[model samples]
Target: MCSASEGQSRRSPISTFSPGALRRVLRTADGVLVEAVYEPCTAGFEGNSPAAGGTAIVVAHGFTGSVDRPAVRRAARVFAQRAAVVTFSFRGHGRSGGRSTVGDREVLDLAAAVEWARSLGHPGVATVGFSMGGSVALRHAALHRGRTEARTDAVASVSAPARWYYRGTAPMRRLHWVVTRPTGRFVGRYGFRTRIHDRDWDPVPLSPVESVPLIAPTPLLVVHGDRDPYFPLDHPRMLAAAGAAELWLEPGMGHAENAADEPLLARLADWLVDAAARPRPAAPDAPRTA
Candidate 1:
């Protein structure tokens, strides 16, 4: 299994960020600890709150990424310019402990991270997730729609896969479908020695397309690279179609390109700030199941 550092040294097109940000280790009830970073903004943009600024954004890393991964770190800084930023590694990634559950348990880890951010006293909280982390963020929004403590004010998902089985015949999509599950099994068993979710629990079921609707009156921004291979451009559009969210098909953008594209970062920051400024929608009551 290749680590993010290995991918970086090889100069892959995936996004990369600078280092030396604030670090925190949060212990979970399961006794697993994860590494999270609080990235401070440079001296240019406004709003400086310890935790939740007037606007706060939590950036989540992709599969096999740590808090130090280039994309996550860069986004943290980007958002920090306008809002307080926090980035964290999922269990079994980076310096965090415990096994990987593909996307199943990672959602819970994300919820915990959000709680941590709220405890810091920020008024508005937005979650920005990439790839697999994108799916996790959408799921959290769906599951905790109206809860006051864990409410998600806004969301942005980049290169979020809407389905586990990529429908595209493109080589990358085909390759991902052919390899993702088997690789997940092999890596969890040997490389990371982690537990796999039960076969009955399909991670795709927790995808953004299904969860984005749950965000409801809470604003959402969905961006995908037009040229992305793993997930087709239509995915985010379909998500927007299912609900009232805004979709951006970044022209000529490819998977995870938001890290390197200054324009995209600017757009993201703009969305965050606008969402923060807009009158917040009253969280609808949580729906109780029969």
Candidate 2:
């Protein structure tokens, strides 16, 4: 019953993991079993830390990234040193189900994963997402705003732009237009074998810029490299202009620095520690529908 393109685009299911990795498969709200990994807390979860009020952190990957991505795994390891860590592949990205909606359905995917992590008996939860995953984290906060009191404690978005509209004056802008338009067209017809939404859907309702106001007062940390080329420096500035979250513009770093730099990881671990110590604010007023 499948078309030639669909059949050709189907990826093989993932059935394994590396030696140090611990895998868990959980069904999503839409009945898809997503592949996730729980890198245990350093010194194990047995005795003192849980009693001492340590928090749990979840790491979400960038666009087309999976739990297996080096940056994601690295961030998990870094945070694992301080707290229990949970990381997962978004549906259709690695070992999960369905297809990519950029940040739309990915937010729901994150929500489902957050719920699963909470059910595992962790007292507090927070999420750190990179790039597209960062946008998804923001959307997740927006969608579930006040509901996270008993679940997620805070969220951090790394190198994620607030809008789909790229204002950078480089090959990156052209690259985005090409990917969101022509490349998406080609992928829809051939590569991924999935129906593509209209261009309007590509922006407006799903944009992080459009959704930033929804995440204010929820204890967000926005970190971006000063020299991130793919997403310009102005991106985080725009989010900060909204004045709802704390912003840290790393000096002279580029996108995906956490994966390659041990210091960044160390800094991130410290940041999470500090973020957990701070009291999170109440959710901002709800959005007005047109």
TM-score of each: 0.80, 0.77
Highest lDDT scorer: 1
Best by TM-score: 1
Cα lDDT of model 1 by residue, 1-290, tens digit: 12222253222222343233456887754667887866544434334435335666787776666676555555666676777777888886766888666566677677667777777777777887787787777777777678656667888778777765555646444334323577745654454333344354442455567777778878888888877756776788788887878888888876763333766886787797687567765777654210
lDDT of 2: 0.64
The local lDDT score (0 to 100) that residue 205 gets in candidate 2 is 55
TM-score of decoy 1: 0.80
Tens digit of per-residue lDDT, candidate 2, span 181-203: 86654664355443333444533
